[model samples]
Target chain A: MDVRVDRDRCIGAGMCALTAPEIFDQDEDEGLVVLLNTRPPQERRAAVRIAAGACPAAVITLTEQDTSTAP
Target chain B: MQHEPSLTEPVTLPTQRAAGCPFDPPAGLAELREQRPLTRMTYPDGHVGWLATGYPAVRAILGDPRFSSRYELLHYPFPGGPEGPLPPAPVGDMTGMDAPEHTRYRRLLMGKFTVRRMRQLTDRVEEITAEHLDALEHRGPGADLVKAFARPIPALVICELLGVPYADRDRFQGHADTIMSMDAPPEEGYAAMAALQEYMAHLVAAKRADPSDDLLGDLACDSDLTDEELIGIGAFLLAAGLDTTANMIAHGTFALLTNPAQAEALRTDPDLAPRAVEELMRYLTVAPTTVRSALEDVEVEGQMIKAGESVTISLEAANRDRERFPDPDVLDLHRKATGHLGFGHGIHQCLGQQLARVELMVALPALLGRFPTLRLDVPADEVPLRTNMNIYGVHRLPVTWDED
Candidate 1:
């Protein structure tokens, strides 16, 4: 899965970081989302999905890719 | 604006919960949600507006920018309330302001309440929670948990964060109470708000003259925000952070007391604290209702909400929506209750949410652990409820524990 976060849209409520600390972190200064792993492995998908869904700002977006078909 | 013949008679907002069911949303609101999730309502000023009760409707209204948060555009939802359009939100009260304006104030404050920052404050929250628990034990056999424990932990934490002297809690807390009290006369609430702003102005000036290492002090030193803005921000943060968390602690305790099985589950397993807090927040939903005005005409759930009309979103009712939460009325600690509107949604979501979570995660479990046999000192029905306040909670939870 591919993950992306929009810092401009983030209100820094920190749901993403709290929900999926491995995939996302808030910048120490502004607390806006900081994407830790843009392409998290399959094991981390559930947490990522929860984090995205739980975000109040809806700042996190995820794209699913077929790993077997990829080069 | 064309209204359907069926929409001629509008339902007034329901304020009273059913007897003996203190934890649930008002029965009338639940019935309304069941019948029509989104319906027209008559405001105090005779303005016809919308009332949203379903979880999806509330979430969609809050998330949509077509709906404005501007205070001036809103029609007061309650009966016999203030008439005409309300005044514009005060300079730093982001709750009543829209983006660009709200964005500036929110951005400056966001960094202070990040997940990492709140985590850093956990040790201090734990210390504060422990200290309050100690006090409760020292004075116990029985005590009003609201005063003796719940109110002080968050009050002190917010004071420390803002560099406000803890000794002055009574002064600011009184002002905050008046501001939050729905029963307070409009003039009195205004006077209390003015007094608080005046106090914050002085604090900001002090912070500007001799900067300290705290939220207000940092803003005073670094930010280019004006004095009025700083004062507004300071008072807003205090009023926002103080009672909301205090009430949550009190109400969560009351809920747990009433539901012994859930309390036991939390007390026995330390790991359940996080999920327990979320469930409690969803169940209790202290800061219940919020209003938003439509900036332009919008269609929601196939209903046309005309421009300039307001919609009162019932966070409490939404949290209890059966579509979103199965057996929504039950307080199940094991339930995964994320995405609840307990702290609300969208850009204007609760700024201090992470901090509130830290305080709750620390305080609630510790309270249950400290007093295993804790239960209400009075009959559950006899405990006073803060029904008249903008935030809902027990006015004073008289709780007791078996002597060790």
Candidate 2:
């Protein structure tokens, strides 16, 4: 699965980090969010999905790879 | 441009739920908006008054100088007042003053609340949130988020911010909650204020004797501020800084968890937290109402508001206004246009907004990242709303995260 964040859409509320710290960190200055990794390894898929769901801005997009599509 | 109060069969104002108190008016304020966008209701003090529920009317009342934020001591409309008897003043006192004087008092302590200053506390906020989450394991099932999580984290932050000893946090946190409650007995509210004031007096004295590198210490060393002013500012900071954010952290979390999609979104994309928190603030609208009084007789939307009439600005109403937001009822975290009165508007807007924002931005994301499987024990609707208070929040939020 791949996750993407529209940086400009971030309002710096930090829900993403609360949701998925492995994927996100707040920039020290300006409080803009940074994506540590857009395409995290396989084991991390669930965490990525949770982070995307918790996003208030709806800016986080989770794209499922073929094998990951089975619910 | 103001619209006339929608003149339909009168429905209750949301604040009326508390037996005619101004605290939680009526629910269909949306209806009132169609009726009279700007209109008067009875004040607890037995005076007729204006209530501004529309987005423009609310913002105008809040940001414009025609209205003042100084009715804190008056006997105008509504319920409680300083007129009955002197209540014990809380941690600080500038909350009762207006503009120039209010501005002057705020300026003395303003140096400490800047975004830059709050950044210094972000790491500590994260640490505190994590520590609390860790402690939840010991709390086991059905721990109250209000007591265990929400109350303590901000209590500690405000304590450390003002240089108060951590051991004294409980007294002040309790006092802060009491003071923030709209339904609190007048005597009880006074006592909370008194407790806070006495607490700040001692802290201020200690700071004077041996100043530290904290906000209280900075105020202590300032030559221009009198001891009285410093004490007043302390009380203001304590009540203003602590209780509001405490409610926000609590309610914001409750808002997210109830909306599983929202919570799930956070779990997957921690980077979206900052924006999510903003959306939470917009949706939760925790600080529901702000009161202001007309400084001068003015006409808005063809309704004449006489000077000194108290006007309540509905933050939730304003945020939900159809004019400012599309699909106002739906939660859209990614909405491009993002100016809401969640923190209030204008000069008297929350001085601690930046600090509160930082705390949420850091704390909320960190919380979800650490507890991936967390889910609420009770249905979201079953969660009790904060009882009869202007500050809306859940009484308790119980959730279980996956063990291991």
Candidate 3:
């Protein structure tokens, strides 16, 4: 799955980081959103979903990959 | 139409529900939640307001940028009263502000409530809870857990957060109580806010002169925040930190006592406490409702909420929605509740959540461990619930335990 964050819409609420800090980090100066993984491996799908769900602005979007196609 | 009622109505305030202030909503609210779900309410002064009781709609309104929190602090045009505007809302604080202004004020105070900073206070919180438990042990038998246990933990934690001397804790508690009281006349509420601000100003001055590791000192040194803003944040934490968790601790204890099965589960396995705490928070939603105004005309679920109309999001209702929580009424310790609006739903979500969680995670287990066999001193129905309280909670919870 790929995770994307619209930084302009981000308010630096930090909920994204709170939900999945492993895959999300915030710029310390402004606390704006940052994604540690542009495309997370299959095993990290749940963390990506949590990050999406916990985003207060609903800015994070996850596009899932069909694991059956993966090597 | 009447205001929409929260979803917990079926269990907490069923049509045949027992009469009391805490457990049951007032007739107007219960009728609204159960029947209308989504409807317009006429404020006492005859103004029209939207009340969204349904889960999806309320959550959307809270998270939607179209809504504003600023108008919440003003005197609204009510449905039927004097021709003049309704008297200004007595309590005005940061929760009522929005956007750049809100963001600025929030930034000044964020670090204090962050998980990183709050972690340092956990050892102190445990020490305080242990001390309370020790006192309860010495004064064992019948004791009001609310006064001795639930209330002190938050009060002390808030004091530490504000850099206030522990000796002043009682004074802050008094102000907090008045601000949260449903029956408090607007005058008393206003007085409480002012008194709290005054106290915070004095504390800020002290912190200015002599800085410390505490949050208040950090805020005091920040040049970005005005005095009013600093005083306001201090006042905000003082009241929020005390009242919200105090109610949660008390109500959660009451919930566990009534649901002995859950209590036993926690007692047998301490690991159950964290999840159990989350369930308690979801099931016994302390805030119950939060009000936000429309920033502009916005449509949700095909309904139009005009700009400036006040809309209330039922946290209690949303958290318990069967769609989100199967068997919404049941207190399942293991329920995988990923999204509950207990703290809130958007950018303005409760910053103090981590601090509240740490307190509960520690307090609940420590509380259970202290008196595993503790049972209510009075019948469950006999305990008084604080009804119409600005926040939902029990008035007093009496429990008795015998030491081995």
Which candidate number maximizes DockQ?
1
Worst 10 residues of 2 chain B by lDDT: B16-25
Best by lDDT: 1
> Model 2, range B68-177, lDDT digits (tens) per residue?
66544344333554442232323236445566666555555544564455777788998898899889866665567777877778778887887778797776768877
**Interface RMSD of every candidate?**
0.7, 9.5, 2.9
Worst 10 residues of 3 chain B by lDDT: B8-17
lDDT of 3 by residue, B1-404 (tens): 99865543322222123464344333454345455566675555445666666677777887877777774333232222234232432232657777776666565555445554556678999999999999999975889989999998888888877777879876677887888876776668779878888888898778788877777787778556666766777788778888889988888888888878888888788887667777887887787766677767888877777876667566776676676788877888887665777778776888788788889988987888878898999988788777646678888999999877
Off by over 4 Å in 2: A1-71, B1-12, B16-26, B72-92, B138-142
Clash count list over all predictions:
0, 65, 14
| All DockQ scores | 0.86, 0.03, 0.39
Better of 2 and 3 by DockQ: 3
lDDT of 3 by residue, A1-71 (tens): 66789876665556667667777876654456778877777677787797688677788987775456432
TM-score of chain B of each: 0.97, 0.88, 0.88
Q: Which is the better candidate, 1 or 2, if ranked by TM-score?
A: 1
| Segments in model 1 whose C-alpha atoms lie over 4 Å from true places | A69-71, B1-8
Ordered from best to worst lDDT, the candidate numbers read 1, 3, 2
Tens digits of per-residue lDDT for model 1, B288-327: 9999999989999989999999999999999999999999
Question: In candidate 3, how many clashes are counted?
Answer: 14
lDDT of 1 by residue, A1-71 (tens): 78889899899999999888998998999989999888887788899999998898888998887576322
